[model samples]
Target: MEIIRWQDDNIVLLNGAEKRPMGKCEAQAVSTLLVIKERMGEDSQLTLLGCAVGATAAFTGFHRATVSRHGPDVLQRPEKQKTMKEMGKKERARHIASKLTMPQRAFLVKEIHNIWADKKYVRVESLWEWAKANISYKYKKTYFFWTLKGLGFVFRKLNNMTVVEERPDIAKLRVAYLKKKKDMDESNAFYGAFDETWVHDGMAPTSGWQHANTTMYKKARMVDIESAQSGPAKGKQRGKRGIVLAILTEDGVLPGSEEILVDDDDENNQKADYHGVMDSNKFKEYMSRCIPEFSRLAASKGRPGVFIIDNAPYHNATREKPPTQTSKKADIQQWLKNNGVSYEAKAKKPELMGTLKNFLTRNGGRQAFTVYEFDEWADEVEGVKILRLPPYHCYWNPIEFLWAQMKATIRGMGSVTDSLPIVRDRALDTLRKFSPSQAAALFRHTRQSEDDVRGMLEERESVEEDTSFELLYEVDEEGVMRNVHISDDDSSEYVDFSDISDFDSTQ
Candidate 1:
């Protein structure tokens, strides 16, 4: 075969004949012609071998007759062409390796070739799995398979590789964000509102508690008409009772300015017909007295802050409605504004309620302390902005912290049968054990420290188990695994419980 150099030829050759020149020729066609000639033998004539010749002539330069009469037999040099074909695979492998990064190339070398040259770890599925996990791109797997085919790598059916791994950078970024937030909270003051909720656990005291208490025990009933007619003994029922003092504090710290009071919730109101803490007149009296007092306590001397409370029926209970048929929220707001205190009803949101629940739930419904020591609680505490913890996170409040300590101390102690003074004194003794200064110091020193932040992030970063193609298989009488498919289209269904229950069992 004549091994002619590649060039843009304007003429096409048929089996053994040359055709007239056709204008400008394509360079790729010229090269392909030279390649075909080198693949053919030396004395081969040009033209007439049918479709390939016609294609060659059509692509490069030629007339139809030359290609039809004399084929592409002129371009066959089978021996040398085989040599070129052999070089193609190795060259392609080199180009692919060159395209990869050092780490990726090394991974491929170690994983695919086992670099030791032993072929011990040269697993196609393992390589595919590694690629699927690490090489994240829309066309990565397709390109990878093409390259693998070009390399002559044995690619048996892999275990259906589909599990995509999370990038480490995402975890690193998340941890950084959490750390930043924790840092921001370190110097800032958090504030919240407070409220109380009572629940029944079933217990009742008879004679000694109070005349009012005894009356409540005798008077309160589920069936109103029957209990009213039946008399005291018939009305009494047995059940335990408990209360939750919810204080939503800012950043889980109790405000040193305010004190939480737990009192005997009066059950023996003269106007027991109304479904509330007090009757109309008593409700009005309560608002007129307590609202001003609480506002005075909650607001500052110079810039009195607004207080947020829920729009509960108890708060809006009024003796009369205006001609405009105005609601109680307006009345309360008016009173608060008149007294130099502003008020707003909190938005009904679960997140706010969650913060409150965090505090109240932890304290087991009891947060006892006296306002008498408010000065001592607030004294000399620098970097301590004593704002009310928002209305629900009482568990985080240090006052509740103190209360927790007290509750733990007296968990199994006999119930308080003594007067309110004795109970108050005992509570004071509990407070004395946990000094506010010491608690505040502890919080300042360890406030959402780096270690805590990391732990929180790690908990959040906890790996999600990969179950992308988890399959279930069962055999029929013919003994073939049946009805297999991919699992869990929704990412949230990924549970790490990791039981083999996901697989089919032969009965």
Candidate 2:
């Protein structure tokens, strides 16, 4: 190939001695050369167009270095290399998109749109599925999601909802209180810890079928006196029947005040495969035995604190049902009238108590007390105060922490086959082994995370939005968007929103 120029200003290439114009296919080629020369500078002209020999070589594709060496040219350019790199990227994206099918194109567009539309932005994969079902399957699920993300669609989550931080002051205070109480020193502080746990009829043995069976039988038999006495003797039983007792105490080692248990293993309990009996007499018997401990705990060190408990029928012999029906709250009111414990004002929102009740019912009734032999147990624990958690506010009671810890520890342990007594024993033993510090540690781990707390606050703030701006917009008979920009003097348009809804002024 050869190239010739008219006075070196205009140049042309010749293949095998045939001259060609710098036009058509060769025009764009020559233009590129000129651009490169302008980029490299006038000094580079010789290697690019020194003579027919060099021109021919340049036309045939010589490296810029070779051209620069012969021509010695430098261009006044800021970032020629960077522009070329960006061009490559654009070309790559175009090439990939061109390979996709028409259905994929539509799906990608719709998925991006759907994610943008959701109040809580949808994830790319999830968004792609919606787009795919509604559009076409030309795109792969994973690819489509990433493709959209690459284009800048964002999937957002409430980042501030978790509790990232805690009030260290409160934690420090709790530690100080515990220490003071342990030392048995008097301080103005009302230092105390409260907790509640269900006592199963009995706990299952760690090993052996015989031991486990015995434990189950022991738990199944933790019923109150009425249920134990009314039923006919089983296999000619001779001694007084044992009673199952559920007591809520202060310290695990101390006896509690309020106590109740199954009177008998009725048909309901049997059907449910639970052999617990509800005996009011047995319940009363257990309560009497624990009464002194309760009194002692309440009057501990000559300082008295009111014991709080829920309004359970067994607590103070109140009406079983609420007063809204034929059964009046008065029935219960009368019992509390003489009882030492005073009922606080009923909770405004009882739903809060759901967590505690659900925990109780789900774990089999508090039958562990039966296996513990409460009367004998109470005789051993000198003084303990019993306090029932006020209804709908189980969260206030520290015992909620105990259950929370237990649930987390036994999250996936398989089903229980032995019996209630065995379950109770195992659970109680586990509880007994756990120190207050260990219990507190478990509570810390199980509670919600920091981000969760912040998100809730943000969510609460969002729900309470200002509506004053709503009056700025108005719709009329014409199907066109309009603004109601009324001034203070425009009383005609100042109708109350409620009244405006009720009117038909057009009629």
Candidate 3:
């Protein structure tokens, strides 16, 4: 083969005729010129343009340098081909869709994630409408949904709830409170936490087992006590018609205290004083008497009581005052009856107010009430200096977990019944099994969660989003596609790069 050498603007065929060379080739063809420059110069071009012999892929770069650079494959970058192979499905889809407009395509992915983050379901039609409104690209709802599904997206139920972002101020206050409690606890005191939960016939939630292959699930059963009406239960025994009030401590139920049942039948029963559900008056009487009795028991064992309790309305530091109108007079009468205060039911408004105020003064008045009983018998009574968990912070309470375990046991029992005796016995039996060691173990779970929350609340100097707007896709359960929520704090999910298509145009 005769070699062709380039002169200024012309090509010389050493063994043939000289000819004027073609001008610079297309910008798109600059890359492939390196692949065959040496061979093209020596004899033939890469291809004959069409069927005519003279037509060929013309070279553009300087002859000597181009041949040298193109001669070795190792000198060139493999980035273009590698990028195509490693590109995620969503990324490639975004790129293809970007032909219409890059901004809209990029914006749509971000909007989908934003809608999902807001806990609003993004339907296909909604996304299609949004794109139509924002861009000139017209897309059918069906087409968009199908394309998204094909590109790896599935309806995934959200499982995480936004927790209260712990501020350093809030954590500081909690630390101070905790330190105060610890100082009080270090004395000769029995550290006892109290929480209340309502137990009814259907409070035990039954769980259903499903086979691994079952693709569809029916509606799930929910244990919603609030939804239960006062009417007779359908096709089943009546639910236990009362509240079970019990206090828990380290060892077990407070000494000399049994689970108190408050229901309709209590008012007409022997000890009329203890009948009915919890109210402000009933709560005050219980605190002044029942808790004091428990405190005595704690003192007997060489420990005063240190009660850890929640702040329910009945356990408020101040009680509400009753209005004195005829309609409201009955309210004060009811309060008197509930607290077992001896008073004339037909008494005038002024007389009734004076008597009630006197009684409230003897007990804990609205102004004087700290919700802690002042009893000097257990030595510095003031209701044993109660420690309160922060509002909405249930992670510090272990009794909540205890209630869950008891309910689980009740659900698992084959002989579980709504009948009073059976329900009462099962509940009491469950409570009896809660030893001090079990309480310690369960409380550790709460303690660990507290530590995790505290660690998460550290002052950060810099923060950033996990995403750089990369079109990421995730999958679970073998081909079940799920939309991944990427967080800077989470590093578990890996973006899938299985999707690839022809990128020769880009190459």
* TM-scores of all predicted structures: 0.24, 0.29, 0.43
Instruction: Please tell me which model should have the higher TM-score, number 1 or number 2.
Output: 2
* Number of the predicted model whose lDDT against the real structure is largest: 3
lDDT of 2 by residue, 279-364 (tens): 34544565566556555654664553323233333444432322222334554444334333244456222322333234334433
TM-score for predicted model 2 compared with the true structure: 0.29
In order, candidate lDDTs are 0.37, 0.39, 0.52
Provide the clash count, candidate 1: 48
Where does model 3 exceed 4 Å of error?
1-190, 202-205, 208-238, 265-276, 288-305, 317-379, 414-417, 460-507
TM-score of 1: 0.24
Give residue 131's lDDT in candidate 1 (0 to 100). Answer: 64
Task: List candidate 1 segments past 4 Å from native.
Answer: 1-181, 184-395, 410-416, 436-438, 441-455, 458-507
lDDT of 3 by residue, 385-427 (tens): 5666655666577777787777667656623345556666677
lDDT (10s digit) by residue, model 1, range 1-507 = 111222232224332534433334444556566666666645224543223544455564656555444444444333432232244555434333334444443344345533334524444555666765765312244345544543334445654212211333333433443454355455343333333332221112222323444455456554363443222222122112223333323223232422223334454432222234333354344334433433444344322322223323444433332212233444444433443543335623343334333433343221211111221223222222223222222332334444455544433232433333434444444444554465554344334343444563454456463221121222333423342222223223322212222222111
Candidate 2 lDDT for residue 48? 45
Candidate 1, lDDT over the whole model? 0.37
Sort every candidate by lDDT, greatest first: 3, 2, 1
Instruction: Give the distance in Å from residue 372's predicted Cα in candidate 2 to where it truly belongs.
Output: 28
> How should the candidates be ordered by TM-score, best one leading?
3, 2, 1
